[model samples]
Target: MTEQRSSPTTSGTTASTGDDGGARTGVAALVLLAACTALAQGLARYSFGPLLLPMREDVIRSYAIGGLLATVHMAGYLVGAVAGVRASARVAPLWLIRTGMAGSVAGLAVLSFSTGSAMVGAGLFLTGMGGALVWLAAPAVAVQVYPCDPGRAIAIIASSMGIGITLGSVVPALVPAVGGWRAVWGIEAVSVLVVLCVSLLLLGSRPQVSARAEESGGWRPDRRWIWTVVAFAAFSFGIGTGMTFFVAALRDGAGWTVRRAGATYSMIGVAMIAGGVIAERLSRSLGRMPVLVAQFVLAAASMFMVATGMGPVVSVAAVIIGTTMSGTAAVVSADLHDRYSPQQMAAAFGLMLIPLGIGQMLGPTAGGWAVDLAGDPFTAFMLCGAVMGAGLLPLVIHGCRRTRRAQTPLITGR
Candidate 1:
């Protein structure tokens, strides 16, 4: 049985009865979703890069242990994705996201007082789990509510990560007076609470969707989708590994001061904002697959530039890498929208993220070891570039096969 949902005011459309009201609601929802994402992912996940060095100097001991904490965080995200997929039937996505935001606040609080690696890791894990729920629900709601222009909606929400990343780094870099990673967590927790309040006010009501199974068939991904999943995993591995260590790369490899490194890292946020907009426009004009392929190549090139450790080159590469990373969602979501039904998208997207989570989990570990081996971040940067470039091979094969199939149909007709 297929489920159907209708809002009393909006019915059959994302907007309400009045044109102005509908526009207001959509704008409000997008803005709120973006803020929520900034809090959930930007602060919760990406903040670690800026905070890690401080924690290491003050309390933590080993780089491997710190990286392992990030790995555990991704593990938590993996679990949360699986849980969200199962629970989506019973729970409203809006409520779930609110709950997740609350969890993030609590996790940050735990981090503020953590005395050991184990506690720190646990806090990060909690934060990641909460972030997964918020991240999943935010885009799902945006796409669900704004079906007419889902790509744009997704782009806006995804761009918030950059906003968050920028803030996460800038705040601490600017406020050395506060001192220590603990203050960063505490301040972020407060900020997240504020966003949560605004999000609750803006998105209090849930879209009415009848919870019904469309098919008895279990979720089974085909071969092409499997490759797509692998591609995403590989791409994410590079992003996860590189971004996780970006500040460290600048400080350790390039002989940059902590403040300078943090300041430079904010450029990523600027790039991300620009990239999301550019990706949306490019995907519409150039096609999603082409954009995806080009992004991977560009990301690889940027990572290679970062490996040079020249201040100017690394700074420029940071923007390019950030742009490429943030644009990933634009192509993936656009392509998936073409392939999957609205109902299936939520579940399918959730499932695909499992591999991404796995890649995220391993990325930090491998990158940290590489850094250790080289006694600098050069090897880690190159590893990210190599992995990102390697992802292109599978995508190219998929594209070639698709082209051949299209030609075969025309040949048969002829």
Candidate 2:
């Protein structure tokens, strides 16, 4: 019983009518969806990076507590992903995402009143939970809408996360000049309101599908997607470190202005949009694993370049990292979607993000602590790059396996 917002269809392809009425309606809906997801994720993802210094300075709390707030958020993200994996396929991705957007407002509101570490941790954890739900549903929804081009659609949604991260950081640099941290958060709440309205308009009372039942005949609903989870975690953590803390990293090391650093990062968002376009087109010809490996390698190199400190180098490098980072998630999702069809798309989605959460959690503290330990940020930056490089080993090995398999039939003349 799949009740979905759909066009009348034949077998594999959907039918198009005169004036393309269905196409117009679908485009409008997609635009609304992108706007809402970008707003929802941007609020949760970037708000913390901009607020990190202010929160620590204003509240007299530990940096550990501050960094851990992101971890807590990712922790909640983990929980939400797990839950979404279980429930999202059973329900509408729109419903879960909307609920997550609403939850973000509550988390932001709670942070406004906090005095210490507990507040930081609790606020981030709950906020992460909400963000996790929204993020989990987004890819699933994108897949539903563009079944044949899920990679491209997922890349777009993933790119939106990058947009949110950039907006989150940059908005503060300007707004705080006028209103302080509280002002930034007030704007966050309002932005979220806009998202809610758009979501209702685009996603309103829509029929939903169960991807789980369609993909899996009688496979267990709760099967653990271990490999998929690991891949996402690695990719997520590597990127998270950059988004959550690199602005501060630039400030601490080179005395770069927050605005300058934030603006530099915005390039990453632009690059992500570009990478997504490439990923979609290439997926048809390059196949899955090859494209993914290339993205990961590029992602690692981008981190290394940043840590090493190249003034002009960052501009081009940032574009490369930003663009490829989001694409990494799309690749992982494609891999999972091709191989498995468990009941819990959301949970599976979230579980895959665990490494991202963990990597994100480790990235900042390690970056900061290494600088603290080494007496220079260059050493610290190099170390973080190394950790990121190490994560790529799994992808490299996986790629090798795929290549060997592809060549096997040719070599044996099968």
lDDT of 1 at 318: 82
User: TM-score of every model?
Assistant: 0.92, 0.84
Name the best candidate (by TM-score).
1
Model 1 earns a TM-score of 0.92
lDDT of 2 by residue, 49-86 (tens): 76776665776354445555666777777776667666
Q: lDDT for model 2, on a 0 to 1 scale?
A: 0.64
Q: Clashing residue pairs, candidate 1?
A: none
Task: Give each model's whole-structure lDDT.
Answer: 0.77, 0.64
Give the poorly placed runs of model 2, Cα more than 4 Å off.
1-19, 60-62, 146-149, 210-231, 337-350, 375-380
